[model samples]
Target chain A: MRLLSHNLLQCNVKNCKSNNFPLKIQVDKSNIINCEFRKEPLVKLIPKLDWNALAITVHNLAKNKEFPEKFSPALLDDQKFMQELHRILMETHIIEGALICEGCNKRYPIKNGIPNMILNDEEV
Target chain B: MATRPENICPPEIYYNQDEAVKYTNSTRIIEIQEQLTERCIELLNIPEGEDQLILDIGCGSGLSGAQLSEHNHHWVGIDISRDMLNVAVERESEGDLYEIDMGQGFNFRHGVFDSAISVSALQWLCVASKKSYNPVARLKKFFQSLYNSLRAGGKAVLQFYPDGAQQLEMITTAAMKCGFGGGVVVDYPNSAKAKKLYLVIQAGGDTREQNIV
Candidate 1:
């Protein structure tokens, strides 16, 4: 799943929907797959992304936390920063991992590049 | 022919491995899905410009999501079947896929989607899949959450195969309760085989989204 989508996803557990901001990543089982990148889509994507969620995911996913803590409209013009932003947003993939919710500690497994967000009966 | 039966197994089991392959690989389903997806998008009347995000409900094998990508729009597909999603993955679908049930509702932040579409999936929620399932309650939850997920004035165009008029009424009533405007739009009404029912819903906030049906 793209961290782009992960940046918007929240833990849908019964009461955890509000604060499930950045679902914690268990990166030991993760893998990165190379993908094609175009600068325009990434440029258009900046405003839609949750800066804090993406930054936190990078830190926990073992990617050395390359993101800046704050979001600036000017970052769109920064060629050097945009290239690194492209690397994290476009190139990396979470092939295998479990995303644990900060609010409910619920774990959603990611297998074969797809994140399984289905919840059981009691959990909902 | 794939109507929702009261005692039918859940989507995961019904669309399991071999069935998923059968559904995705069928030439007829692919043709039908393509036509239905395009029809739904045409009804969306998307304001053109940059790449917008669309949500595909029950996006089996990414056929519908591919249509969204053709317009350079991004999409996120949610389905209840893993095997179906596996095929979507193999297709190198531009959109991401998630295994989530529509009955319980989605997990998107407020005002995230530009618009939404569901093809041939809404009928599944009309029947009780489990003993604990309540049709009215499930429909309410789905509508309420879907109402919140869209940007104000965002539209969700859902194409469903209703068993009867009663089923359509139930779904529409629930949506109305959650503050949705717009109503059912029937395409090709004279031809039984080609007839399709679409619910064109707009999230109510400030502006009322008028239905073009």
Candidate 2:
């Protein structure tokens, strides 16, 4: 799954509330695609993104890249920053991994780049 | 052909590897899926040449997702079937894919998607596939989360095959209870084979009377 999608996902295992969001990514394999950078969507999506969570993901997955831990409106003016943000959000894909819920510690496995979010009856 | 797959088995079991591949490769199924997706996008009525993030619930093998890509939209697809998703991976589908049961509900951070679509999928939630499954509660959960996932003024066009008026009422009522505005649009109402029922849902948007059919 892309980090863009990951940013939107939260753990929903029964009544496991509090810190359910930003499921911890355990990456076994990851890949990157070269997508044309679009400045408009990235700028628009900035407010919706959890910068701290995204920064952590980038730190964990793309160590060579420098990303700010906090978000700022002025970051929109920096084309370089927008491009990096776009690359991290749109291009990076987690191919194989498990997303562990911080609240319940439930492991949602990712295979073939598709995370399995299906829960059992009791979990629901 | 007389019996629906949703009635026969749950999505994960019904769309096993063989079935998923067969469904994806069939020229007829592809043609129909493409046409329905085209119609759905038209009904969405998004501004031309605009890119928006879309959510595809029950996006099987990325057939409808291909249409979303063709329209230059970013999409996240969630399906219950692992085999179906494997086909999507093999095709290198552009959208992010996830294996999620729509009945149990998904928790995407509120107001993330600009719009959403589901083709021939929603009615499955109305089926009591397992002994533990309660159709009413499941439908309520599905609609509630779907309502939460879309941005304000966002819309979702869901095409489903309802068994009868009762099923239609059940589905629409659940959506309405969750604070969705808008209603069903039945296409090709005179022709049984071509008839398609689309639940055009608007979340926190001013009600528009256009396309009431």
Candidate 3:
């Protein structure tokens, strides 16, 4: 899964509140799938993003890479910034691993590049 | 298409798209639904002689149903929004359309439908803020109702946004708990638009598996 997606996910398991969102990704394995960048859609999405949270999550996931500390008007207009954003958001894929929710402490297993979220009746 | 009225509803309001571009190029929504439907048909392998009764949950503007109608099958559509249902009703053929909130319950009898489909609607059921209601619980209730409504071999096609790995797992876990056995199909991984995933659940009964192409 991309950090773009990680930013929006929050644990919904029965009032498991407080920092449930932005589930932490423990990457056991990952794969980078090359994807073409689309500028128009990226431009449309910039306004809706949580820039700081995204940067932090990307930093956590990538370790070595550093994203802009802030989203400036100039940065928003810059094509280079968008291209980098696009690469991080669309190109990164977690081929295998688990996304553990901070709130409910549920581990969503990723197999064959797809995350399986199935749970037993007792857990539900 | 005319300019959207000035008194546009808030983002929290379901099916309220102020931007005409969202509606016109809703190709993302349309394409995902088509892919899911095609997959469902392949998986079910419904015989030509048996009557095919299909139910579309949150059948907005009836676009999904319109596509299903091409197969000359019996269908029914239900939606919570009156405006959306009205649009759907106008486009409907022999099928019945009802203004029913799926979060509450489908209000159908057990094994009544041959198949069911919901697309781009579950996320709207979620109450994003304090003033809004949490429809996720209601959604679970709805899925239970759907499980009851389908025949032993019946299938339900649901297309929703995983948001992230956690959300994806949450939804799949919920579906399995609801008794659906199938995997998900990720549509358009690269598009910055709302990335959609199709979850096809087949009710366990007949050994014959339907092929989802």
Candidate 4:
């Protein structure tokens, strides 16, 4: 699954609705692909994002790479920052792993580039 | 399209292997699905000149996703049928597809999607595949999660082949309980063969905005 979708996903556990975000990523394989870069979408998306969660996801997904510890509005114009955002959001992928919710500890599995987000009856 | 009593089984089982392949290969199904998808997208009043994050619930074989791809929008689909999604993987679709039941609540972040659409889906939720399932409760769960995932002013156009007026009422009432506003837009109302029901729901958008494309 692309970090783009991962960044927008959270635990669906009933009571954990308040703050089940920044799902902790534990991966065995990571894939990086080349996709055409367009800056407009990312700029429009920044306002809707959870900056802290995004920073953490990038940190885990882009291991050796660097991302600002915090989100800066000025980075929207920085070509380099936008490129990084594009890479992590659109290119980097998790092929096999599990996303554990930081809030409720619910686990969602990832297989074949698709995240299996089906929650058990109890969680629902 | 003849009614299939096979609806009694869960989608994953009913759409398995041969059924999935037949659906992708059938010209008639593809034509109807394509038209339904196009009609739904037209009802979703998303302003142009920007890429949108669209959620395609019950996206089968990426047919609906293909329409979004043509518009140059990024879409993520969730489906309950794995066999149908296998056809989508074979096509190398541009968007991401996931396996999940819409009857259950969504695992998506709040207000992440700019718009949403469903084609020839949602009606299945009316029939209980399992003894534990309740149609009204399931519809409520789906609409509530859809409302939370969408941006305040975003629109979600669901084109469903409702079993009857009762099913349509149940679905709309569920959406209204979740603060969704707007009404159904029917296409080809005079022709039963081409009739389509589109639930054009807007999440907290200004009521004065009456522009319908």
Candidate 5:
């Protein structure tokens, strides 16, 4: 799934309450495939994004590439800013890797550019 | 009667809080919550014990707590929303309600509960925006607290939603890391939208496998 989707996902087990969300990503391997960037989508997503969280994720995936420190109206309208976001949010794919949750230490695998989030019998 | 919005009851029932509340408050939500609790009680395999202390997380309107209370058990219900708690308090007999943010953590002494249950609450841990809170980290703290709060062998029965099979795996993996021994129960009758499932975790249990690495 997109990091955008990962950022919003939470665990819904009845009472599995502790840090049960955005299950940490443990990317054992990854494949960043190219995808078209859309300015409108990025602009639309700004309101839904956890800016700091997304920035941290982008930085981590981009090998420490820094995202802008602040979010401003100008940045929202800037095509350059939108392009950067477009590249990070949509283009980056986990060809092979896993997303591990720091809270529960769960690993969500990314295979064929898709995350395999299936639990084992012990974890059922 | 005014017509409800078409988008109100989308495929997923949990995405819209208003719709969730409406559904949860409706007769169907109550029945579903009760059934889920019954399933939890069955899974808990609660052995005969007098005065067992139980903690009900996200005890919305006290549906689950009320059912537990009916069994003559000592119950404490907590929720972040006062409005929700108020509804719970009204349904309950009395004196067992607290306004608490589960994401932050429950306010009770360690080793206080014999068992705990949260119904449809874990999903609320995620912040709509990243700036809101690190819900995953918050949830980790919550589980640690639960581990510390429960007497050895105390079981916590919880229900939450996984975005899909992928989300479920991530949670099960996390639960294992927290030293919980159990499995995810995929029992959602409906699957068009997001599916709701249950996880029965035992505290102070042996750590089994290293799945997340």
Candidate 6:
């Protein structure tokens, strides 16, 4: 799973509504695949993102990296910054990890880069 | 007539390791899947020069994900079968894979996807895989979550094989109840073997938009 997907997913465990988003990334193994950066796609996707969530994940998993706590429209115009954002969001893959939901503390395991989001029948 | 695999077991069990490999290795199945995927993309009618973030529901073995990649679009795929997702991982599919049951509802943030597509998958939701499963409730959850996941004008093209008129009605009605607009498109309606059913849905878009049947 990539950070791009992680930014979108929230815990769907039944009746656990608050703080379900931005699952904490517990990375045991990670991989970086070099992909060509496209500014247009990222430009369009920027508005849809939860900036705080993205920043938090980057800070937690990607140590020493600091992105602005707030999203600035000006940042979209910077080619180098957009490239960096693309690499962090799209290229970095979580090979083995577990996403811990803040609300219910449900651990969704990631194996071989695929996240298992299946919930138990009782939970659903 | 051969019995439906859905009647035998749920997707996760039915598409076991052996079945997953056999399904991917079949030339006929691959060809059909590719053609249907291409058709779904065409029906999506995404504006030219835009790279979309697509969601592929029930993306078995990355067959449709490969097609999405060929179009240079980024995609996230969700499927119920672990064995099928393993095949997708082995294939090194460009799209991210998630082991999720569609009937359980999507977990994505609101308006995260530009468009969505499914091929040969929706019918599985209409069948009760377990004693406690309620098809109506499940279908409502699936459609409601799907409606929430797409952009306001985003579209989804789902190609499925309905068991009969009743199954088709159940699926369409659920989508409509969730505020989706548009309707079914039947291709090659005159031919029994070539007939294909596509549920072309748009999220809160212009209700007057007509589908090419």
Best by TM-score: 6
- In terms of DockQ, the best-performing candidate is 2
Scanning candidate 5 chain B in windows of ten residues, the lowest lDDT window is: B4-13
Q: Which candidate is the best by lDDT?
A: 6
| TM-scores of the candidates, chain A only | 0.87, 0.92, 0.83, 0.86, 0.76, 0.95
Residue B124's lDDT within candidate 5 is: 57
Worst 10 residues of 2 chain A by lDDT: A57-66
By summed lDDT, the worst window of 10 consecutive residues in model 6 chain B runs over B204-213
Tell me the tens digit of each residue's lDDT in model 3 across B1-213: 343321134222445533322552479756766766665555556776444668878766667776666675546666655455544434433344544555555434456567888766655544433344354675676778678777777887777655557666766776688887887876677885645577778766644354532
Instruction: Provide C-alpha RMSD values for all models, in order.
Output: 2.8, 2.9, 22.1, 2.6, 20.0, 2.7
DockQ of each: 0.78, 0.87, 0.01, 0.71, 0.01, 0.84
Q: How many Å off is the CA of B209 in candidate 4?
A: 4.9
Look at candidate 6 and give me any clashing residue pairs.
Answer: none
Task: Put the candidates in TM-score order, highest first.
Answer: 6, 2, 1, 4, 5, 3
Give candidate 1 regions above 4 Å deviation: A28-36, B1-7, B205-213
**Shift of residue B62 alpha carbon in model 1, Å:** 1.1
Q: For candidate 1, give the lDDT of residue A74.
A: 84
Q: What TM-score does chain A of model 1 get?
A: 0.87
**TM-score of each candidate structure, all chains considered together:** 0.92, 0.94, 0.51, 0.92, 0.52, 0.95
lDDT of 3 at B85: 51
True contacts kept of 2: 0.98
Task: Assign candidate 4 its CAPRI class.
Answer: medium
Question: Which residue runs of candidate 5 sit more than 4 Å off their true CA positions?
Answer: A1-124, B1-25, B127-130, B188-196, B205-213
Candidate 3, which CAPRI tier? incorrect
lDDT of 1 at B171: 94
Q: Which pairs, if any, clash in model 4?
A: none
Query: Which residue runs does candidate 2 get wrong by more than 4 Å?
Result: A63-65, B207-213
How well is each residue in A5-105 modelled by candidate 1, as lDDT tens digits? 88878888887755688888775454455666677878877777888788877776656655678888788788888877877776666778777887888
What is the lDDT for B116 in model 1? 91
